[model samples]
Target: MITAIRRMFSSTIGKFLALAFVVLVGVAFALSDVTGNSTFGGIGGANVAKVGSEEIGLGELRDRVRLAYNQARQDQPTLTMAAFVESGGLDRVLDQLIEGMAFEQLATDMGLGVSKRLIDGRIADIPAFAGVSGSFDQTRFQSFLRENGLTEAQLRRDLRQQLLLEQLAGPIASMPRLATGMAQPYAALLLEQRRGQAAFIPASPFAPATDPGDAALQTHLSQNRGKFTIPERRVIQYALFDAASAPVPAVTDAEIARVYKDNASQFAASETRRFAQVIAPDQAAANALAAKVRGGTALAAAAQAAGLAPSMSGELTLSSYAATTSDAAAKTAFAAKRGDVIGPFQTGLGWVVARVEDITARPARSLADATPEIRAELAKNKANEAIVDYYNTIQDAVNSGASIEEIAADRKLALATTPPLLASGRAPGQPGYSLSPELAPLVSQAFQGAAEGEGQLATLVENEKFAIYAVKNIIAAAPPPFAQIRPDLLADWRLAQGQKIARDKARAIAKAVEGGQSLGAAVAAAGPNIGSVQTIGGRRGELGQDGQPVPPEVALLFSMAQNSVKTLEIPGNRGWLVIALADVQRPDPKSIEPARVAAIAQPLAPAFGNELVEQLAAEAKRRIGVTINKKLVDQLRQELTGNAPVAE
Candidate 1:
C-alpha cells in the first residue's frame, strides 16, 4: 500500500500538482494575496469544506483546481477558465478532494495512521528532493520548499493524510476473491463457440423510386446545412529563406588539405572477415563436425549430415564479431589465414566449427580521394552561416514594420501566394490542395496568425529554413448554395432511399425466419443476387476466413436463443444482414483451462478493486457527513477565474 501510494505521488500527476501549486503561489504573490486574507478576505478565511471534524482549507482547494486546469491544458492547449468551468473540471476536482478527505476521516475514526518516520521515508524517496549523489539532501529539499512556497510541516501533514487514506482503502480494494465470481461468467461467454449463417441484401440493388428534384434538394440542404458548410480559410503570401538558396563561398584546395590532415583517422578502414559456422549442442558434436571438415568434407555437407544448416556470418570487424560471438571464436578466426578452416572452440552458445571464406585488411585513403567530401561539408557550413546572417537582416526589416513584399524586393528572396485554402488543405469536394511537405509548417503558422493581421516569422525546418507569412485575405465559413451541390444531394438522396428499401426487405426476411422459415429459403425467395447463406463458426476472438475478428453481427447471434433471428445493418451501407442463430456450443466449465481463466481475470481484477474503492469512499462520505461552504467556494472560484459565479 505504501509503495503504491508513493508511486502515484511520484508519477506524472504528482509533478503536475507540484507545478500547479507553484504557479498558484506565484499568482498569489503577484496579486498581493499571499496571506489569503487580501483577495478572499471575508468569513475570516475559513475552510472550504469539512468532513466530520477535518477541514479542507481554501488554499488547498484553489491549488487543486489550478492543478486540474493545468492537467487539462495538456489535452486542450487553449482551454480557458470559462471553458474549464463549463466542462465541469472544477466540480470534478472538488469531488476527488472530497472523496480523499472522506477516506482520511474514516481512517482517523478507525485509529489507523502513518508514523512520522514513514512520512519522512516517503519524502526522502522522492527523486526531486535528491542531490547529485542521489540521496535525499536537506539543502535541496529546503530550497524546493522555499521556491514552491511550501512548508515542510505542511508537506508532511499532506503526506500523512494521503498515507492514511491508502491504509483505509488498500485492503478492501485488494481482495482477490472479488474478481473470481465476476470473471467466471465472462470467461464462459468468451470461450463459447457459435455456428450461424447470414445473407446480405445489398443496398445497391435497390434504386430510388424517383430522382430528388430541386425542391427536395433545397429542403435537404436546409435541414443539414452543417454538412455542406465549408470551413474558414486563409490566403497567405510567404517567402522562404534557406541555406540552399544562400550564396556559399568556394572551398580552397589548401582548406581541403588541412581538413583531411586534421581528420585522417576518419578516412581509415577497419579489417573485416566473412565466415560461415556450424553450431553444435556439445563439444563431442562440434569435434566430430570439425574432423569431417578437416577430412575434406564440404562444410555445408557436414552441417547437413549433423541435422543443422550452415549459417553465414556476414563481413564483420573483430570487435563486432567479439560482441556477437565469443572473444575466443573471434580471436581464432582473425588469426587464421584466408580460406583456413578452424575453431571447434566453445562459445556462449555451446560450441562452433568455423571456416573463413575471405579477409579484408584496413587501408588509408590519400588526400585527393577525400577532397570531394570535405569541400561539400565546407560549402554547406558556409551557406548555413550566410543564411543566418541574412535572417538577422530580415528580422531587422520586420522590426521596422517593412511589409513582406518590401523585404522580398530588397533582399531578392522568393515570394509566392496561395489561394484561399481551408486548414484541412481542401478547397471544396476536391482532394487536398497540393503543397510540398516542407511548406506545411508555414501554412500552419499562417492560419494561426491570420487574426493578428501582421506578418510572422516561423521556423520551417529546424536550423535549415525559415518563412515569413501574412494573411492576404480571409474567407469565412458558410454553406454552399443549393445549386452548387445539387448533384451530390441527389446522389445522397438516392443512397438513403435505397438503404430504406434494403432495410424493409431485410426486416421481412427476419420476420419470416422468426416465424420458423429457413434462412436460406427466405434469402433465395428475396432475390437471386442476394448471395447464398454461408455458415461461419468460431470462438469470440477467433478470426474468420476474411482474417477479421468474428463480425459484431455474428457475436450478437450467440447472444440470442436457438432459431431466433434478427436484422442488422452492415457498416458502410454495403447491405443489411438477416441472421438466424443456429447453435451455441458452450464448453463444459470443468474442461476450461485454468490458464485461460486466469488470463481473462488478470486485467479485470484492478478494475473491480477500483470500483469497490469508489463505493467505499461514497459510503464513508455519507457516514461522516460532508459539509461544503458554497458561498466561500463560489467566491474562491470567482477570484481564481475572474468570472462571475454560474448559478446552480
Candidate 2:
C-alpha cells in the first residue's frame, strides 16, 4: 500500500504536463525509429543533432530521456536505468526529438504559425493549473512554470511549435476514408484458409543415454551464468510503531469551550439546496419543458420525451451553486420553496428549467452540543502529534548509533529481522516467503541505501505509523557454488542436448518434405518415436471460442506460400514441430459483401493515414536535413549506463 501511494504521489503536475506535451509534440513519439544511426562519432559538440538551422541540444536530449525513463518506471518498478538505455529507449527518444524539431522547422519555413491566444487556451485547458475552486488559476500556472524551471515565453514557444506541427500534419493524418473497392482484397485475405500437416518431435524422447559428468555441467554453468545468477539481496532489521501505541493528550472542557468561542463562524447557520434541472439549446424549449413539469408530468419523463436528460445538481450553498451554474439560475432556484418548479433562466450551460427538489438547513449549535465533536477532533490531532514525536525520538536514537534492536529496546517495541531478500522482498530460494505488511515497504528502501547498517526512518502509513530500519547484511548477486546446483545443471544440460537433437530432426523432416516427400512418410522415416502427422487448418481471421488468437503454428501455416515446409520450436523447450502447407483457399472477392468490405476498411483508414504521415515526416526530414552527433550520443549512452571510465 505504501509503494502504491508513493507511485500515485510521484505522478505529479509536471508528469501530467509531460504526458500532454508529448502528444502536442508528435503522435509518433513512441513509434520513433529505434534502429537509427547508433555509431556515435561526429564533430558536433553539446548538441545531439542539427535539424536544419536549429540544434537539438544535448541538455534537451538528456532531460527528455530522463523524463521518459521516469515515466516508464511508473509501470515497471524493477526497470533499471542501464536496462532502459540498452533497450533502445535512448535511441527512440533522440529520434523523436530530431523528428519533432525537423517538422517544426519545415512548418515554420512553410509560413505556418500558431497564435498566442491559441497557446493560452491550451495552457488553460490543462487541469494541473486549476485552483482549489476547480478554475484555471494564473498564480498556480506561474508557480508550476517556476517549479519546472520554465519561463512563460519558453512555454509559449513550445506550445507554438507543437500547434504549428499539428496544423501541418493534422489534415493528412486525420480521419481517412477508404473505398469499398480498395478494401475487398484485404477482406478476402482475412477470409483465406490454409490446411497443413504438422508432426511433433518431443525433445524428452531424444535425451542423451550417458551422464554428461560434473565437468560438462560446470562448463555449461559457466557459459550460462546469467541464467543462474541471483540478484543482490539484503538482510534488514526494522522496528514498527502505529498511532494506536502513541499517547493522546487529555482535552479539558475549557479547551473545548475556547475552540468554540474562537471559531464561532463555523457554528453559524447554513443552507444547502439540491435541484433537478434540464438545459435546452434555446429559451422556447426551456419554457416548454418548464410548462410540462408544471402540468404534473415528471421532469425526467418530460425531458426524455424531448430528447434531453434531466440531471440533479448536488447540494450547494447559494454562492457555490451560482459559480457552478449561473447567478440567475441559482437565484431563481434558491428563492423558490421546497418542491417548487422554477427557472426559465439562462445559465452558463444553456437555458435552464429547474425544480427545487430538496433543501437541507443546519441550525447553529450551542457550546454543549458541539463539545463532543470538538473533543474528538482535538484528541485525534494530539494523537497524530504524539505519533510524530515518537517517530522523531526513534529516528534520533537511530542517528545516534543505536541499532534497530537497541532502539526497539529503548522504545519498548518489537524488533524483527527479515531473511536476506531481493529489493522486491522475495527471499532467494524461498519462493513462498513473504514479509509482514508493516515490513514490506522497508525492503525497497533498505536495498536503495548502503548496507553498512546506516539507520533510516520511513513513514509507513503517514502519521498513523512509521518504521525505523537498517540493512544488516549485503549479499552480492552471483552464481551459487558448483555443488549447490549440480543436479539442476545436469537436468538443464540434458534438456538442451535433447532440444538440439530434436531441432536437427525437425529440419531433416522439413527438408525431406520440401524435396518431394510426403510429410507422414518423412516423419515415419525419422523414427517411430515421432508423433503421427496431424492435419492442422485455420482461417486467417479465425478466433477460438473464447476469442483467443489463432495458435502460432496455425498462423504460420496461413502465412506460408503453398508447398512450403518450415520448422517451429515449441516454447519452453517442449519440442519442435515440422509444418508443411498442403493447400490454401482464398475467398472470391465477389463473395464478400460490401458491408464486410466496409468493416475492414474502417480500421485500415487510420493505418493509411499513419503511413501518409510517415511519408510526410520523411519528406520534412529531407527538406530540413538532420545530422546526428554520433560521438556525443555514444558518450551519453555510456554515461547513462555507468560504463564510462572514471576520470583520474
Candidate 3:
C-alpha cells in the first residue's frame, strides 16, 4: 500500500496535476473577478459540470482552461486563446478535472480521509518549501500561499482531497507479478525461426520497348495532373540580426582575473589515488583479506586464498571513487596515506578491501592558463546583449513602417531575396535553396499566403534572433507547362509500363511454381529479366539479409505447411515474390531458458496493471453515473472560441 501511494505521487500525471494546482491558484486569484459568476445561457449557471454529487464550478473550469491555454502557448508561442479553445483544449482540461472529481467522490464513499498530520507531513516533505536548513519554514509556506493567492484553509482542503484520491487509485495501478506460463508462449513465438526460398522480379529489369509518343504523354499528364502540381511558393526578402555578426566587446585583464577568482574551485583539479581492491561476498571475508594485507601479505595472495578476484584501479578521484564504489569506501580511501590498507566496507557490489598504491595532489591552474576561455565567454555574453539591443531597434523601425531593406542597408545587416521556390525550399532540377538556420521560420511565414508587400516579424532561434520579412512575390501552385515537364512525363510513363510487365511476369512465374516446378526452375524459365532466386533463413523478430524485416510474404512461409508455395505481391514496384516454405523451427519447450522468458515478461507487468486499472476506472464511472450539460458545454465552447452556437 505504501509503495502504491509513493508510485502514484511520483508519476508524471501526478506531478503535472500538482504543478497545475500551484500555478492555477495564483492565476485564479488574479483573474477571479474576470471569471466569476459567468453564465452560458440558462444552462451554465454556477456549475459547469457535476461528477457524482461534486460540482465543478464555472470559476474553477475557467481557471483550468486558462492554465491549459498558458501551457499550449509555451509549446507553440504563436498560439492564441481562440486557437487553443478551437483545438479542444478546454474540453481536455474539463475531462481531466471531471475525472479527478470522480476519483475524489469515490474516495469519499470509501470513507478514505487524510488526517491533519499527514497533510502537514506532505507539505513539509516538499523541497520547494524547505529553507537553507532543509526543513519546512512557516514563513516560507505562508509567503508562498500569499503569492499564489491561496488561503490556509483552501490549501488544506486541496491537499486533503489529493491524498484521498491517491489512496483510492494507487492500489489499482500498482504493478502485479505475471506468471511464467503467461509469457512463455509469447517468448517462443518471438524466438521462432524459419527458412524459405524467395524470388524477386524487379520492375527496373523490364523496361518498355519505347517511350510514349507526344499525344500519349499529353493524355497521361492530363489524367495525373494532380501528381505533378507544385505546392505554393514564395519569394521572400529578409534581414537577419545575428549574434555572431554583432561586435564583441573587448575583455580586460581585470575582468579575466575577476572571473578566475570567483570560480577558483573550478580551476582547481581534484586529488586522485591509484588503488588495488579485493571484493568479497561478506564483511567477514573482506575483513580477513584486509588483515592479511595489513600484516604484509600481498593483495593478490590474500584474494586467491579467500577465493575472490583482486583488481587494480586506475587513478580515481574522490567523486569517481564514490561513483564506482561506495561513499564510505571513497572517504576511507581518500583519508588514508600511501600503502595503507583500508575498507571491509559494505557497498552495492559487495564488501570491499582496498589499498592505496599511489597518490597525486592536483594544483590549481594559474590565471594565465585560464585567460583564453574566460575571455571567449565574456565576449559571447557581450555579443548576445548587443544583438538583443540591435534587434529591438530594428523591430521598432519595422513596426513604424520603415522597410526592412532600408534598415538592413543602414545598419549593415545581412539582407537577401530568395528566388521563387516551392514550400520545400527547392526548385525542380535546380540546386536546393535554404534559409539561414537562424532565419528558417521566415520560410513558413512567407508562404502563409501573405500579400506581396505584407511583412511580419517572426522569432528565429527562439530569443537569440528574429527576422522581419516581406513577401516579394507569390507563386500559385499549378501544373507546369506540358513542354516543361515532357522529360519527367516520359520517364514516369515508361516506369508504369515496366511495372505492368514485371507484374505479369511475376504472375506467370507464380503459376509455374504452383504447377510443381521448383522455385529456381520457375524463375529460370521466366526469361532472364526475372532476377536470381535467393534462399533466406527467416527468423521471427530478426531482419533479413536485405537489412529489412523478412518480407511479409517470406514471414507467412512459417505458417505454411512444409513445401507449400504461395505468391504474394511485394510493395514499392519490387514486384511479386513466390516463397516456398522449406522448414519451420520451433523452440523446444524443455530447452527454453526460464531466465530469458522472465526478462521478456518484466516489461509487460506494468502494462497489464495499467490495463486493469483502466477497466476498473471505467467500471467505477459507470456505477457512479455521470451527467453532462450539453447546452452548457456548447455555450462554453462558443464563448471561448467565438464560434456560432449550434441549434439543439
Candidate 4:
C-alpha cells in the first residue's frame, strides 16, 4: 500500500519531465569539447569531462547520479527486489548525470527562466506535501525538502529552469494532427478484428523447438535491435543509512493499543458488496426502460423488447466501487437497490433508471490488521528517534565549534577515516553508507570542500528520520566483465527472434490486405487460427455474455480508424499475435452519439503528474549557475575505479 501510493503519482509524463529537468540545462549549455585544451589538470585534476567552462564538479556529478539512480529504481521495479543492486542501477545514474549536464548547457544557452509562484504552486500540489488528512502541510513539505538537501529558494530556482525547458519543448511535442491521425490506423485495426469465434489453445500442449541456424539468430538481430543491448547498468557500492541503520525501537503493545483507541478514526471499517446492473443506451432511454419494468414489465421480457440483456448483480467492495460512473445513467443507477426500482437521474450523457437487486455492507479493515505500522511509528517516538539524534549531535558539534573529528569522538562515531565515495555509489574510497539520504548533505559538503580526509558540517536532513552525516570517502563506478552479461545476451537474443517473426508477419499481412485482399480470403489463406475483426468505438466495456466487458486489447484495437490496413504485433510468453486492420472511425466531436460505449475506468488518472511536470520545469529554470567541484570528480573516479564517463 505504501509503495502503491507513491507510485500512483509517478505517471509517464512526470517521468519524462523529470528526465527533461536533468537534461534541460545541458542540452544547449556550454560544451567542454576541449579537443586540444588544458583547462582540466588542476589539483587532483578533473576525473570528469568539463561542461563548457564549468567544472563537472565531482560533488554535483554524484548528487545528480544519486537522484537519477533513485528515479530509475522506482521506474524499473521489476529489475530488483525492493531496492536497487549495485550492478543494475549505477549506469542509469551515470546516464542521467550526462544528460543533466547536456540539458543544463542547453537551458543556459536558451536563457530559460521559471518564476517562484509556479514552483510554489507545484510544491503545494504534491501529495507528499499533503497532511495525513489530505490537505497541504507546509511543515511536512518543508521538512521533506530539507531532508532531501534542498531549500525553498534552491528548489524554486531549479524548478524555474525546469519550467522553461518544458515550455521550450512543449510546442514541439504538442498533440498535432499527425499524432491524432493515430485514430485512423487504430480504427482499421479494430475493424479487422471483428467479433468472431475461434478456439484458444494453451501453450501447455506444445513443446517449442530450438533454432539451429545462425541465420535465424542473425535475422532476429537484424529486425530487433532494441532487444539485444544492455541497459548500460552501473554497479555502485552504496552504503545506506536510515530506518535500516536506526534500530527499530521496542514500543509496547499497551502504547500501540492506547494510540489506536485515541485515534479510532484511523481504523477503517467498510462493507464489500457484489452488484449486478443493466444499462440502457442513454439515460433517457434507460429511464423509459425502467418505467416499463416498474409498471409491471418483466425484466427478461422487457430486456428482449429493448434490445438489451437481463442485467445481473454481483459482489464489490468500497475499494472497488466509485459513485461517479462512466455513464451518468450508470452512476444514477447506483442509487437503486436490486429489488427496488428507482427513477433515472440525469447524467452527463442522459437520464438513467436502475433497479438494484441487493446491497450488502460487510466488515472491512481493522486496527489489529494495521498494528505493525502503528507499533513501528510509536517505537520511533519512544526511542526519541536515534536517527534524529544522529543528525542533532552533528549539528550541535558543528555549532559548538567542534571539528568533525571531535564530533565523531564524542558520539563514538568514527571520524571518516577515508576519502569520500564516488558520487555514483558504485565504488567508494571510504567504507560506509554513501550519501544515503541520512548523509547526503555531509557527502555533498565533503566532496565540495578544499581539504581531503577532513569532515564538513551540513544542514539537518531526514531520510527515514531527521538526521545529518559526515563523509570522508568517495568511490566511482567501474566497468564490469563482459562475461557477467553473457546470460543477459542470450535472453536478449530469444526476444529478438520473437519480435522479428511478429514484425515480419504483421507487415506482410498489412501489405497484402491493402493490396485488395478481402479479410475472409486472407483468413482462409493464413495457417493460424484467424482472429476476428471487431468494430470497437472510443468507449469500451459494453458487457459481453455473463457481464464480461471488453479488455484493453479491445480498446487498443480501435485506437485508430482508416481504410488503409495496418497490423498490431502482440508479443506474449506463449506466442505473438499479428493483428491486421481493415477499417476505421474518425472522431466526430458533434457526433458523440449514443452507443459510443465507454468502460468504467479508474479516475481519469490522477492529474498530480500533469501538475508535477509543469512545476518541476519551472523550478529547474530558476537557478542559472552552479560551480561543480571537478577536483572531487577526479577523486571520485579514482576511488570508484571505473572508466565510465560521467554526463558532460
Best by lDDT: 2
Question: What's the CA error at residue 165 for candidate 1, in Å?
Answer: 18
lDDT of 2 by residue, 1-648 (tens): 112211322322211122225432221112112222222233223677888887766656655565565445444544555666887778876766666777788888998888778998988876656543346867556544543445666566667766776787777766568888878888999888889999999888887866789889889987766556665577888777888777777999989999999999788788899988889999999999999999999999999999999988888898998897778767777789988998788876798888888999999999988998999999987886787667656655754667777777877888788888776677878878878776655665565444367677665664566787878898765778888988778877887788999999999999999899999999999986789899999777664646776777887787788999999999656789999998999999878988888998998787677667677778989999999989878988887665675233
lDDT of 1: 0.69
Q: Which runs in model 3 stand beyond 4 Å of their true positions?
A: 1-178, 202-207, 210-212, 222-234, 244-382, 395-403, 406-410, 421-427, 432-479, 508-528, 544-565, 570-574, 588-591, 602-648
- The positional error of residue 4 in candidate 1, measured at the CA in angstroms, is 30
lDDT value, candidate 2, whole model: 0.73
Best by TM-score: 2
Q: Tell me the lDDT of candidate 3.
A: 0.68
Please, what is the whole-model Cα lDDT of each candidate in the order they appear? 0.69, 0.73, 0.68, 0.44
C-alpha lDDT (0 to 100) for residue 624 of candidate 4? 34
lDDT of 1 at 316: 93
Tell me the TM-score of each prediction against the true structure: 0.47, 0.63, 0.47, 0.36
**Model 3 TM-score, 2 decimals:** 0.47
> 518-537, model 3: which lDDT tens digit per residue?
88998998888677888876
Using lDDT as the yardstick, the better of models 1 and 2 is: 2
Question: Could you tell me the lDDT of residue 226 within candidate 1?
Answer: 45
> In candidate 4, which residue ranges exceed 4 Å CA deviation?
1-69, 78-156, 159-391, 395-492, 528-556, 571-576, 580-648
- Please rank every candidate by TM-score, starting with the best: 2, 3, 1, 4
Q: Which 10 consecutive residues of model 2 have the lowest summed lDDT?
A: 25-34
Q: Model 4: how large is the Cα RMSD against the reference?
A: 17.9
